[model samples]
Target: MGDFAEAVRERVRRAREAVAAAHEAGDVYAVAEAREELDDALRMARDLGVDPGAGPEDEHEDPR
Candidate 1:
């Protein structure tokens, strides 16, 4: 479980860094790729038990 969390964190961090670099380089395609990678990491995190939705306090709000 801990290993999975660490992997997800690492992937997310790398994706964010890539996005920053892409922005600095003015590469729109790269930015889009990074965003996709970040989304994938988020999905993996959710699969590993991380809630990818609003918490109890935010339940009243529509998720969609």
Candidate 2:
């Protein structure tokens, strides 16, 4: 993966973590906002033709 892809991947990872944190904290509004950010990151990755390796379809795949 190129630098752009790596950066986007990092963004997606951070966004995902944020969403999880918001959910854990029981912050409804924060969860919604974080979800939106994650959605945007996914869309951006798709548009850039970057395989984020972190999507619904990859949920069951081994991290390694």
Candidate 3:
């Protein structure tokens, strides 16, 4: 993977870890915030030119 991909992956991994820790500590808000961070990382990946899958048009359609 390129630098951008690696950076996004690291962000996602850290967010997952944060969520797990927050869950164990019973912090709902922290978990939600971590999830939001993960979502931002995904957006960053897309902005960095990563093709995750089909675009919005395919959301309601089945891909074979």
Candidate 4:
């Protein structure tokens, strides 16, 4: 992956972690914030020629 893709990956990873933590803590606001961040990250990934698939594995493994 290129530098920007790698940076996006890190953002995605952090967003995922934030979502998980927010869920575990029962923080609705945090969850919403994290989801928005994740969604933005996914969109950015797609714009950057990455496939935002059904799951993270698929996203990274997309042939195109």
TM-score to true structure, per model: 0.70, 0.82, 0.63, 0.75
Task: Write the residue-wise lDDT of candidate 2 on 40-64 in tens digits.
Answer: 9989999989987755425843112
Whole-model alpha-carbon lDDT for candidate 1: 0.65
Q: By TM-score, who's the top model here? A: 2
Better of 1 and 3 by lDDT: 1
Better of 1 and 2 by TM-score: 2
C-alpha RMSD for every candidate: 6.9, 4.6, 7.3, 6.7
lDDT of 1 by residue, 2-56 (tens): 6767777777667767766777788889878976886787678677876434322
Candidate 1 lDDT at 1 equals 68
Q: Which of the two candidates, 1 or 3, achieves a greater TM-score against the reference?
A: 1
- What residue pairs clash in candidate 2, if any at all? none
Question: Candidate 2: misplaced stretches above 4 Å?
Answer: 55-64
Error of 1 at 53 (Å): 14
* Best candidate according to lDDT: 2
lDDT of 4 by residue, 1-64 (tens): 6777778877877877787778778888988898799878888988888654455434554111
Error of 3 at 44 (Å): 2.0
Candidate 3, lDDT over the whole model: 0.64
Candidate 2, residue 60: the lDDT equals 49
- Count clashes in each candidate, considering only residues at least 3 apart in sequence or on different chains: 0, 0, 0, 0
